[model samples]
Target: MTPAPALTLARRQALINRTDMAGPGRLRLVNAAGQSLVSIELDQPCGTVDATGVALTDTEFAQVTTTGEVAGALLEDAAGERLATFTAGLASTIPAPELPLPAAQLYAGAFVRLIGAHIVCD
Candidate 1:
């Protein structure tokens, strides 16, 4: 067996480009059972790829529609097609370098805000 080669920054950027080709994207916060908590519209072009990976644009506040513990996130195209999924949690609990939420506990009608988040590729 052979080990797979790690992706270079350029390669990572290329992958991101393809995923974001549809322009503008959405980040849907979901619970362990895969129920959506809230869906926030991302900026057109979504983010810029660089050494730090995909630097997501800050998003406007969106109201949470369901109450549950946020377990992960679904990245989707503007049309709601899934692009990727990533582990999610409170800023101090998530193992990933980015994709932090203000709190893991969410309730309907509560506003969720996303800021300084990124799709880090390593």
Candidate 2:
């Protein structure tokens, strides 16, 4: 398996917010290859992230959960598995660890961006 990336990568990835394609009030996690990995359902008036999705796992399958609040938002799985580390609104250039990016980890980084946060995927 490949390792994940640092938190800052979330702000760096190419993000395409196609809420129209994703239906109403939704955000997508897509790859460079244009694969929509996951879709998060959001209620605009509520001011929170609420959705559960079936995402591909190393073995078979897993549920991707999203939750948002005034403090912060979270995207995680049943086992409390997190794809990246996240912090909101990165102001400066945060250094990235010198490593290779595998496809799965890249998606993890995007998940952080979907939640509108700076992320770390250690």
Give candidate 2 regions above 4 Å deviation. Answer: 1-24, 46-122
Give one digit per residue, the lDDT tens place, for model 1 in 1-122: 43243456666666556556777678898998999999988876677777756777788898999999999888887667887788888777726534666778899999977787777654
Candidate 2, residues 3-121, lDDT tens digits: the string is 34432233223111221123333333333443444545433221222121111111212233332211112333323333322332223323432111222333232343232222233
lDDT accuracy of residue 100 in candidate 2: 15
In model 1, the runs with Cα more than 4 Å from the true position are: 1-7
| Reference-based TM-score of each model | 0.79, 0.25
lDDT of each: 0.76, 0.29
Measured on C-alpha atoms, candidate 2 has an lDDT of: 0.29
lDDT at 79, model 2? 31
Could you tally the backbone clashes for each prediction?
Answer: 0, 9
RMSD of each: 3.0, 16.0
lDDT of 2 at 56: 18
Worst 10 residues of 2 by lDDT: 51-60
